[model samples]
Target: MRKSRAVMGNLLPFIIAIIFIFPIIWMLFVSLKPQGLGISNPLKWFLPPYTFTNYVHIIADFQVLRWLLNSLFVGIVTTIITLIVTSLAAFAISKINFQYKKFIFIFFLIGLMVPGEATLIPLYQIAQSMHILDSYIGLIVPGIASPLGVIVLKSFFDSVPKEVIESARMDGCSLFRIYYSIVLPLAKPALASIAIFTFIGSWNNFLWPYMITFSDHLYTLPVGIPVFNSNYSQDYILPMTVNAVSSIPLIIAFFFFEKQIVKGISFSGIKG
Candidate 1:
């Protein structure tokens, strides 16, 4: 009976996953269908004749390309910055003994607990004051130091054996040397997880970027989707196709780091 319950629990989630994926699958199908295909029953997407008109047209659309490039740049920059800031902070907090270290860690963790909306107005005002509105720095700077990244990496570091760090220190390794060479390599799984999270957050960020970046050229994927849709006259198929393409990198990252991703998340919850 216990085995049966475990099997049911496992199988139930798969059923739910398929149900969730149905809409995405349908959207991909509709993107393939030409404008003439009847959408009265949208689920009957496979019945229509397939064409690359939508994909080809979207490819020709310059704004989508521009938005993609902007998002790619911002996301890459944000991810790199977030990883460095968070990792160094996490490493210091985990491995070092400084006065008020706990206070500082708690301060950074405040970012994780609080919703971004609470800080949006102030962040906007600051951006305006600094004349960074519509600039990449305006979008990227605010998010470079993630509280969750610090918390996640800190947990991973806590799991590392202390002896290794001691040995490295005895070998005349500086604190930064030990952190970069010894600690980070063991926490590669956590780093992979952090990079994925940072990339996804930056790629999908619309509200903050929208609030700050007024220029059409600076829009990221989420904000860009709406702009593209407006031009398409609510012809969602083309925009959704472009969205699917943009999601490919995120999806590929998940696929490649599936194991590390799972381990990094689940085990991080288990403290030393």
Candidate 2:
């Protein structure tokens, strides 16, 4: 019984992984099928008269590279800004003593309960008032206010030994110096986890960018791919091809940062 349970535990991850990865695999397979063909039959999906025609057409016709660059720009900028803002905020909440600090942290915690979709209208109005519409500033700015990053980083920051912070203070280190030199280094795993989530979220973000930007040139990959699909609505394979292309960056990011992601989750689970 014990051996069976242990084997099942070991096998569980592989089973879960396959369940998650299967859709992406199916998407890629369908995208590889000849352009006009639909996957109405599951058996015909693998028996592909496979071609790169859809990829070639998408690249030639659409602003795919431009859309990719736009997404990369937005994702990178959003991640950097979120990391900076959330880390500072988290450090202050976790380490600094201030009036109503608990209230402030609780406020951020409340932000987690508020669904992002609920804020779209107000966020749009704010962006409009700022006149950042149809621009990268609009794309990148609104996403920086991440409550999740704050919560994760604060949990990690709280785990940092108070003794080290006091020792730094006794050494005449300022709060900024302590944060920059000591706390930030200790919170690398949490930071990595936050960064990955922020970048991926920004990359996959569609609604805000779609609603804000009117120009085709300003469209991110997620937004752009859908627009392309709208024009070629009858053709199924092209949309899949574009989706497959768009997914490449995220897949590469996950694989490269797989260890950091695991470490971050483990550390957060243990510390938090």
Candidate 3:
């Protein structure tokens, strides 16, 4: 009975994973199908007779390429900006004993609990008032410091040994030197984790970009996919192909960084 139960437990997860993965599998299959195959009976969509036309169609579509570049720029910029700002802020909160420390930490922690949707209207108004509506700055400035990133790095920095800082200071090292040479180097795993989170969030962001980005030029992956899908509803396979192609970079990044990502999260919760 015990052996049977253990086998069942393992098999059960495999079955669940298959169920969850089926849609993406179906999408890839459909993507390989030609335009003629798109309008075929729903049941027949999975059969062979695949073509490369979907990918071809996207390549021929120049606007999609431009949109890809725009998103790439935004996502990369967002990741860099957030990583630097959050790392510095986390370093400060952990190292400096300033007035209102508890209150400030709590204030930022509250940002984590506040849903983005709830804050959208006010953010839009502020962006408009600041004359940054429909600009990349509009998207990036608001997203510079994530509450979770700060919290993650704060704990990681706290785990950093004070003796190291003292030793460096005894050698006449400045705060910046200590952060750059000692602390940030040791916290590489945590920083990588933060970079991945920020990149994925910015890459897949739809709602805020959709609201702020007035031109067709500004659509990111999530938003761009739907627009192209609607425009080419007769060829739904194209959008599926685009999505598959778009996810490739992220999937590859995760494959390589999975260990670092997990370790970062783990260390954030640990003392050393």
Candidate 4:
């Protein structure tokens, strides 16, 4: 009975992984099916009629590369800006004593309960008034002040040993030095987790980008893929292919930094 339970425990992760990954694998297989190949039986996808035509046609016909680049740029820029601003704010709130600090933190926590859609119209108006609409600045600026990012980093910062911070202070280390050198280095796992989540959010964000960007040139994959699908409504394979292409970057990112994600979540939960 003990041996059976141990074996089941070890097998559980593999089972869960297969369950999660099965849909992505199925999507890829469906996308690879040759054009004109009807899905009379889903199992037929395993046969010899697979072709690269859908991928080739989408790449050659659609501006997938441009959309991909736009998403990549927006995602990376948003992640970087979010990390920098939130980390500094978190460090100050977590470590440095200030009047009304608790109130400020409570305000940020309130923001977490507010749905993002509730502020879209106001944010859109502000962007329009600032003349940043249809620009990269418009795409990148709105997501920078992430309350969740601040809260996560603050929790991680709070978990850092107070002794280490005091020792640095005694050595005449400036707050900036302590933040850049000490806190940041210690919070790598949390930072990595936040980066992954922020980047993915920005990349997958469709409604805001769609509302803000009128020009086709500025459309990210999340916006562009749907447009492409609508344009080629008759071609079922093309949409799937485009979707598969759009997902590659996210998959690659998770594959490389999955460990950091797990570690960061674990560590952040320690104090929060």
lDDT for residue 167 in candidate 2, whole number 0-100: 91
Q: Candidate 2: give its CA RMSD in angstroms.
A: 4.0
**Candidate 1 C-alpha lDDT tens digits along 1-272:** 99999999999999999999877777678778786444777557777588889878777878777888888899899989888888998999999989999889778867666777888888788889999999989988998855777888898899989998998899899999999888999988788877876777788887888888688877877888877777775556776788776776777887887886676567446522
lDDT of 2 at 155: 83
Per-residue lDDT value at 211 in model 4: 95
Find the candidate with the highest TM-score and give its number.
3
Assess each prediction's global lDDT (C-alpha) against the native. Answer: 0.81, 0.86, 0.82, 0.87
RMSD of each: 3.7, 4.0, 3.1, 3.6
For residues 1-272, write the lDDT of model 4, one tens digit per residue.
99999999999999999999988887788788888766777678767678888888777764887898899999999999999999999999999989999999999888777778999999899999999999999999988876877888898899999999999999999999999999999988778888987888899998999999989989999999888889886657778888999997778888898887676566446534
**Alpha carbon lDDT at 139, candidate 1:** 85
Using TM-score as the measure, name the better of candidate 2 and candidate 4: 4
Off by over 4 Å in 2: 1-20, 34-44, 258-272
Q: Candidate 1 has which clashing residue pairs, if any?
A: none
- TM-score of each prediction: 0.85, 0.81, 0.88, 0.85
Per-candidate count of clashing residue pairs (backbone under 3 Å): 0, 0, 0, 0
**What's the CA RMSD of model 4 in angstroms?**
3.6
